[model samples]
Target: MHGPVSTAWSLVALCAATGAYCLLRMRSGVEEQRRAAGGEALMGFGMAVMAVPAAVYAPPRWAWPVYAAVFGAAALRALWSARAGAHHLHHAVGAAAMVYMSVAMAAAPTAHHAHGAPGVPPVTGALLVYFMGYVLLSGARLVPAAVPAAGTGSGGARARWGDRPELARACRLSMGIGMVAMLLAM
Candidate 1:
């Protein structure tokens, strides 16, 4: 069965807000933070558009292909960036998941919408498992730990807004949860 309209609207709001925050984050002086924020913002906005309920706005036929192409490029870029660090590999996987979902939706829009559509495909299942693990791990990181304030040696009280690691992590957590919801809907 299709999800409630309110759920779709909530997702839209959440994603859009996350995107906005990421855009602000891109203003950070750190080059890497700006780059990462840019990518996260794109993903947030793209997910927001994809998550829009079909009943509210039926996308044009060409939209899914466009989604696939955009995310595919992102996936490739993430893969190329992966050599610098392991996190880029995660980004590549996330982008690839978006591509997979877009391709599936395009291949059989009707089937996806149909209650009798074939049971969860293996790829979707794998992505779900991966994202669930990410969500849990991110959630765990949010917990307040009793660690010493070593960060005090850095930008103490005058830290830039975009440099807040806690907020950035929260934004990632929001997007991860959004991904799970969108994948489940698919």
Candidate 2:
């Protein structure tokens, strides 16, 4: 695989790891009330995994249906949860990004002759954008917490939210760096 693809894969791996960490951090009550966080993280991980095959092989035309279904389902489910503005928006945007990537991956077989082709598929760029957005938003969510003494209100709230503010910030940055790597690869 090329450098961009490798980078993208690395980002996906990091994102997945962060997602797993989030899942582990969840409390029983929080996990039950807002399951979407874990689910979204898992989906992010899955999307990252999906990137692997597309990165290495010229995906067959037939893979289009599966790609669409998987991403579409994840997006729809995310939007349906409507957990919070940030969470919902993130999921919705991610789903749309996945749609773009799916189409790009589906067209990989004809990439050689396609107009505006890059060494990596355009979808790879889309995926990078999506994951990057995920990283940014997720990280932004942590910023209020990372800042010490921003006010006790949110800081106190972060305790109930799952994971420390500092750790959450680290996760977001890590995810963002991963997305950057993926984008670089592309």
The C-alpha RMSD of each candidate to the native structure, in angstroms, is: 2.5, 5.1
- The best candidate by lDDT is 1
Q: Model 1: per-residue lDDT, tens digit, 83-153? A: 99888888898899999988887876576456765688889899999999999999999988976566565
TM-score of 1: 0.91
Per-residue CA lDDT of model 2 for 115-147, tens digit only, reads 773465566666677777766776776656454
Deviation of model 1 at 86, angstroms? 1.0
Candidate 2 residue 61 C-alpha distance from true site, Å: 4.9
lDDT against the true structure, each candidate: 0.87, 0.60
Best prediction by TM-score: 1
